[model samples]
Target: MRHTWLICGLAICLSWGTSVRAEVTITPDVVYGHKSGLAMTMDVFTPTENVNGAGVLFMVSGGWYSRWQPPEQMQDRFKPLTDKGFTVFAVRHGSSPKFSIPEAVSDVRRSVRFIRKNSDRFQIDPQRLGVYGYSAGGHLSLMLGTASDDGDPAAKDPVDRVSNRVAAVVAFVAPTDLRIMVKDAPDRLDAYARFPALDLDLKAAEADSPLVHVTPDDPPTLLIAGDKDDLVPIEHSRNIQAAFEQADVTSRLIEVAGAGHGFRGEDARRSTASMVEWFQSQLAP
Candidate 1:
């Protein structure tokens, strides 16, 4: 009954059907960029059937720390999207302690540009790309969805010339405004002490916070969070959702009653379906 919950909240033991129904060509460790002489990587999963020419990026981050697992082993975990004809990319960024939040955000932005540049090869519309992740991964997802770039046409690198904007996003239980994360806590957070990425000056935190960047041009986003989540908290999602509405951006917030940072049983099923439907509606031509 344990399924690998892949996203920013860590590897959560949960319940989900693990039967791999969709066939896909699994390409692992595709280099998206290089940082400090190390290659940033993403695994590409292309469906063998029902090719929809749309791509979905799953941010492989938790607590600003990224991790990787072989793509072959995650077929079932990706089946919900792949079955919907989505080309899924499991994108990993520089981890915390070694790399900070600003660096992680920069890495994924480059990854988006990289993917958009190679859209023809990947056979997905550069414009139809979407993103998904939970918790810390969700934070990155919102960052991508909110603070996107038009790409410098005069940039030296061709990939950097492609826009980093996405078509849609599914940010689950993400901390929207990092600036308040430390101060609003009921007590001192041990996480801030342990995770260097969580500890930031107001300026740096504001610069990295997605809530600081919501705009009218932001792509439609569907946020799913548990009302009972205490780790990242539900207020994070609520605040961002409220901002989205005020900005007149197309958005939806699905609060899973009695759920937490991670979903299970019927909660997981509903959240997964919500993500799929959002993408289907938003990514379509």
Candidate 2:
């Protein structure tokens, strides 16, 4: 749609000492979408030095809950990508207990479209965009990768005319198959308690699940999961890998030994490195 974006002046910050430093510019609270009269915003991090001409969208979600973290607070999580010359867009979606999963997904999709539609302003290639997320965010990343669509040319809104597809995706500890997840642990259904108004429709669940949308045209995906994860079983990644194989799509599954749902210490560092490498390889210009 032809929505309005309130982009503020760039705030520049230096990383490290003068000898080896990176000039990073951050623009916070750029409106991308609105629901219930509330604006959905994102923080855009652009490396003023050594520009890569590519962007990676990061979903800040855990347990289906999303909160906006300032650029300074997320420096550790995004420094790896920024150091590698990749622009980062940290997107925040509507949280649960007030919004449903479907609504959150829609907000993310709209954010992608907004970025693509205004890629020139960001000084990056629209087609070279990639996505990354952990836990519930990872699930949404896969959803975007598998279920993206080209915008309608007939739509009057220019943003709606842009495509939502990405070149690559990195999802960590995501639930690819919701049906299987609920079957394994019925109690997990409690996560969806916020959406009690919806009917119990199996077809809706199948349609919403990322596993059912895999196709050859889907973006190359890297699924990372900890073998010791009890919250989201490792089998979820395995099943997603199998689905990718069946669809003849490019996909990889990484199982971290002795790691749980949340990787820590060396494991966390390794996961971060792996994601940065994957994005560099897939989204590099």
**Predicted candidate 2 versus true structure: per-residue lDDT over 1-285, tens digit per residue:** 100101101122233211223467777777887779888888888887888999999987776677655567776668899988898999988876477667778888889999998898888999999998987788889999999899888998788888999899999988787664433335564534433412235555566689989999999999999998766779889998999989988888999997777777898899999999899889878
**Cα lDDT tens digits for candidate 1, 35-70:** 898888888788889888999999988778887775
In angstroms, how far off is 145's CA in candidate 2?
Answer: 0.5
Using lDDT as the measure, which candidate wins? 1
Tell me model 2's lDDT, rounded to 2 decimals.
0.78
Each model's lDDT: 0.84, 0.78
21: Cα error in model 2, Å: 8.8
- Provide the lDDT at 54 for model 1: 96
For model 1, the stretches where C-alpha displacement exceeds 4 angstroms are: 1-22, 182-188
Number of colliding residue pairs in each model: 0, 1
CA shift of 187, model 2, Å:
7.5
Among all windows of 10 consecutive residues in model 2, the one with the lowest summed lDDT is 1-10
